[model samples]
Target: MLTPEEWAIVALSLRVSGVAMAVTLPVAFGLAYLLSRGRFPGRSLVDAVVHLPLVLPPVVTGWLLLLAFGRNGPVGGWLEAAFGVSVIFRWTGAAIAAGIMALPLMVRAIRLSIDAVDRRLEGAARTLGAGPWRTFATITLPLCLPGVLAGLVLGFARSIGEFGATITFVSNIPGETRTLPIAIYSALQIPGNDDAVWRLAGLSVALSLAALVVSEWLARRGQDDRAGHVL
Candidate 1:
């Protein structure tokens, strides 16, 4: 049984991870589609930028985010002036950090699925009088749904475990920016908090494992479905 405080932490973590997924999903899909199908100028550059966070140290990513989205940063300053909204040291900022960290994973998974789709099927649909948007909605998206779902699960898991970037972006303010990973770190810093640390750590591991298992299962199912479609 978790203490009330621990439960609150868990709930906040879920909310942040869920919001991050919601915010990232459409952008991830759009990038995946563009990368898989479009041949625009700077395509490689865009792809590299999309995956930059994956290669950069999390702290570096966080630092860049702070520089870009902090109140004094250009984008952040404009947003504040225009909308009167601020994310600094808030849960929203933490969600942004988590979403960014998870974006590459989501985009890569969805792009792989999109690439596996047969072009001929799309062409056939177009020939049968379907417009591009209709063909994609009816043929392409359905075939790649499993991968999208898998990506969502994988991204959510990544968001749940996000630490370095989140801490850097939002700091570990309880009831706000402190998520599972941050909570674990906080527990570790306190003397004689071994029991709390163990409990939180165990919960985090279990959640991550479950998400990974589901993601793997979804990916395999997608592959099997594609194989059957081919046969």
Candidate 2:
């Protein structure tokens, strides 16, 4: 049986990961679309910047976020002063850190999906008098739905497993910013918490496996759809 605290951690993890994925999806789609289809100055730079979090140390990324969103920081200060909002040492900061960390995987998956789309098909729609938004809604989005699902699952997994950046940005606060990974880390720091660690570790492994399975299922489903389209 799971303890109340464990259940709280699990529920909070789900909430944080869900929120992160929700916010990241549209931004990921936009970046993927730009990378796959748009052409303009500094495109390469933009691409590099989008994937920077993937390469940088998690701690460094967290520190940067703190500088940008901490209580004393300009953006954070203005937000607090204007709307009484706060991100530092809070759940919101954890979600932001997780989302940023998950962004590269999200963008990569969606960009590949977008690239696989048939431009000729889009052209046909345009020839038939459909505007860009209309064609994208009816054609492009449907074709890439599986990819979007895959990206969302992958991003959710990443967010749930986030640790270094989240800890740096929000610290470990039970029922607030302490997520699954942080809980696991906290378990490790105490003596005779091996059982707790193992239990949490099991949950983490199961979550990761489920994410992988779903992602693969979505990929296969996308492939079948593509085959049908080709036929």
Candidate 3:
């Protein structure tokens, strides 16, 4: 059981991760479709660049984000000047860092799903007067539902554990940007916050387990649906 403050951290973690996943889904799907199906120059480069965060150290990624999106940075300057939105030391900034960390996983999962979709089904839909968009919506999308769900859940889980980048980018300000993992790290640093540390750890474990179970259930459901159609 968590204290009220600890519980708030857990809830904030979930909200941040969930929002990150939600934001990543459509973007991932679009990127996956372009990678899996589209033809263009520099495609390979684009793919590699998208996956760069996967290989880079978390702190490096965080620093890069800070450089690119900091209040004084180029894009950050433009965004702030245009809309008065500042990402530095903000919850939204934490989510952005989490999203960046989660992007490769989301893209990989979605790409695999897009590849698994039958091109023949897409052709069949086209043959039946479906436009490109309609065919994708009615055929390709449904077939790739399993992968989409898996990617969303995986992205959420990744976001939950994101600390190095998040802390570096957003500074873990309490109640604003201190997620569960951040809280855990801070508590463990204290001399006698053992109870808080243990409770946060337990919460982390439970959340991870729940995410795993949900992913498994979604994958199994997809398989069962496929089996039913086969029968």
Candidate 4:
């Protein structure tokens, strides 16, 4: 019973969230690994910086992003001049906003998994002539796969639900930046648009719930798998 426009909005939301998660996954893993294992100076500072968006107002985050990545901003200007790329007011910008908003959750989940890994096992692998990179690839990453996947799901859910940051960065342009949350907000502004609001809101709830359920299932399955492996 959804209209074509509604379906389009849903599709756009999925695309933005999916792309955001995909783009953030590797970066999140790297940061998680660093935070969980590295002992470099300024580590606390780095961690705080990484988690800043979580505590900062969404509008503030969005405005900061605008300052950093808007056409006139240094990074954005460089990108535009050197690569002819412009993310401002585009779907790409929306993806960036979603990714930033979801990063802390992703990093935290992955970091916890990394911290739970057995350092002794890594040492054993090293004793067997496995290099750090090799051991990480063969042991650490596999052990933490479940957490990484859970993080991705959680991040995807966050991305889909993103509103304030996305709206500020991308302006809710239809067929571009108007995700499900934005669509719902749009519907709410007009009179007698209850049906549209309800439909979009329902879809949003379903998607978020589905993501959380999957994340939980993945975490539980991971625990079971680790237990069986130990046995």
Better of 1 and 4 by lDDT: 1
Q: How does each model score on lDDT?
A: 0.95, 0.93, 0.87, 0.92
> What is the C-alpha lDDT profile of model 1 across 32-80, one tens digit per residue?
9999999999999999999998999999999988998899998789889
- Residues 64-103, model 3: lDDT tens digits: 9999998889989999999999989888888888998999
Q: Where is the poorest 10-residue window by lDDT in model 4?
A: 222-231
User: For candidate 2, lDDT tens digit of each residue in 1-231?
Assistant: 578999999999999999999899999999999999999999999999999999999999999999989778988989999999999988988999999999999999999889988888999999999999999999999999999899999999999999999999899999999999999999999999999999999999999999999999998999888887674
lDDT of 4 by residue, 1-231 (tens): 799999999999999998999899999999999999999999999999999989999999999889989889998999999999989889999999999999999999999888877788889999999999999999999988999999999999999999999898879798989999999999999999999999999999899999999999988977876776463
Error of 2 at 22 (Å): 1.1
**Local error of candidate 2 at residue 10 (angstroms):** 0.4
Question: What TM-score against the true fold does each predicted structure earn?
Answer: 0.98, 0.97, 0.94, 0.96
lDDT score at residue 178, model 4, on the 0-100 scale: 91
Error of 4 at 4 (Å): 0.6
Which candidate ranks first by lDDT, i.e. highest?
Answer: 1
Residue 125 of model 3 has an lDDT of 91
Off by over 4 Å in 1: none
Model 3, position 77, has a per-residue lDDT of: 93
